[model samples]
Target: MIVRPRMHWLRMLFVWRGSVVPRILPRLGFFLALACLAVATGPHPFNLREGPLGLLGVALAIFLGFRNSTAYDRFWEARKLWGSLMIVSRSFMRQALTHPSPALSLEERREVTDLLRALAVSLNHQLRGTSVPLDALDSGVRERVVAAEHRPARVVLGLAEWVARLRHQGRLGEVLVTSFDDNLDRLSEVLGGCERIAGTPIPYVYSVMLHRTVYLYILLLPFALTGSLGWSTPLVSVFVAYTFIALDTVTAELEDPFGTEPNDLPLDAMTRAIERSVMDLAGEPLPPPLLPDKDFVLT
Candidate 1:
């Protein structure tokens, strides 16, 4: 989501907009203060055996690494699902345009195209638990779909009904209907995938355990290092804390990629892209594509 010109070495370190540094800064400062206090207060060796602390740091690093990997998997899977939506919509256009069907009138073709666009928009809204944008659909179809419990599912059902009507009218043969139905089914699967991601979360215990361990390790690190590092402990402690805390924050954000955070998936841009692609394939005048804002964030 953070889109900008490549930065030089110094600028990259201080870049704040998209990084998790801001969120974790307060914690880092607190640890730095603890480090200074430990050194100024005669640095009580904390009697804290360095051996145990070193071992714990190693174990904690492994755990956080695994946690990040799992969260990234979820984020990547979500992105692929949205990509599938776009692919299926484009495929629908190809088959619908080529199908020989008098029952599939021009108006109905446009209606079905809008339905596909609305399905994309509806899924975006649904995952965020926001109201369906009736504006994304035609008045009549919107009225019916908005009344349904699942807006996206309703739109897809309408599409299937349109296909069924075509087949019944002898405009579409079995082969054409089957092809259209396959795309429709895939749309359902994509919607279900998004719902699964939104409804189910990484286990609460895993997060709790990591959260506790991270802060505990950060807070105790200064005491362990102050004996030898002396006044320099604050600088080194803050740097180390920054990496661990920032990584944790990144994982937390990636765990829910549907969010509006800068790092989250650009659902707004994606849905609009679907609309433009659908419009272009249908021979309609194209709308302007969505662009990143001044901050270089898309959503």
Candidate 2:
């Protein structure tokens, strides 16, 4: 995600790297050429009226607004799920470390903490459809988790088993174990929610339909306006095309918030945060927090 400090209003106009303007520039240029051609050919060759096109623009704006809203809802919901994951992980670790009758051995504490760390890394990879590195896992379950079909789910199960073992060893009472179980369930929900977003996307047909309509509108716009605006058709048409095409491109990126795009959620930074938080709770050296790049983007 782009995480830059606020810029001056004038500087904002020229900013390029993280904005969608760069992505739509080629399309805007194409529209500009078409608009120039329309001007050369004289007015309304196809008898397309500005009135209908104006109404179409309004309708398109409404649809684009709706799609953008829906896509942002998915993006925000994903961020919240990750936030919940962080909270539940810390609570689970605090309970495991402080609630038992006798303090857990340092080795046992490391084992459980590593599982939580592994779970976070695995989930990050799973969402992006990338491989989980074996080195990112705990030694005890590294091979098993790497070999599993769903790495995050397997790590979640490992957590439950560890809690059950503690209960059997008389380290935790029924009530305390139940509390642990509840947090584990929250972890599982976080995993499931991420999977849902990654597996299912905004309906392909709806997106394609809107995409086609947007281009079609932009293509016909110059012809409609040339008769009225004449020499200024290219400027107006290209500006209108920029607005529609840019919005469409942005919504497409937000629809899959787990991607490595400039505007997508910063999964790498978030996973690192999970690691730092878990290590701090385990009384181990914490890794440094991730920072955005010079371009103000966090992957």
Top model by TM-score, which number? 2
- Model 1's lDDT to the true fold? 0.86
Question: Can you tell me which runs of candidate 1 are displaced by over 4 Å?
Answer: none
lDDT of 1 by residue, 1-299 (tens): 67789999998988889997778777877888888888888647348756788899899999999999998999999999999999999998778777955535668768878888888888899887787766756787888778888889998898888788778888889888899989999999998999999888899999999999999998888888877777888998898798888888999999998988889999989999999998888887777888989889998
Runs in model 2 lying further than 4 Å from the true structure: none
| lDDT, candidate 2, 1-299, per-residue tens | 99999999999999998789888888888889999998998854468889999999999999999999999999999999999989998998899899887889988898888888888889999899898875855678797688899899999999899999889989899999899999999999999999899899999998999999999999999999988899999999998998899899999999999999999999999999988998898899887899999889999
Give the Cα-based TM-score of candidate 1 against the true structure.
0.96
> Poorest 10 consecutive residues of model 1 by lDDT?
100-109
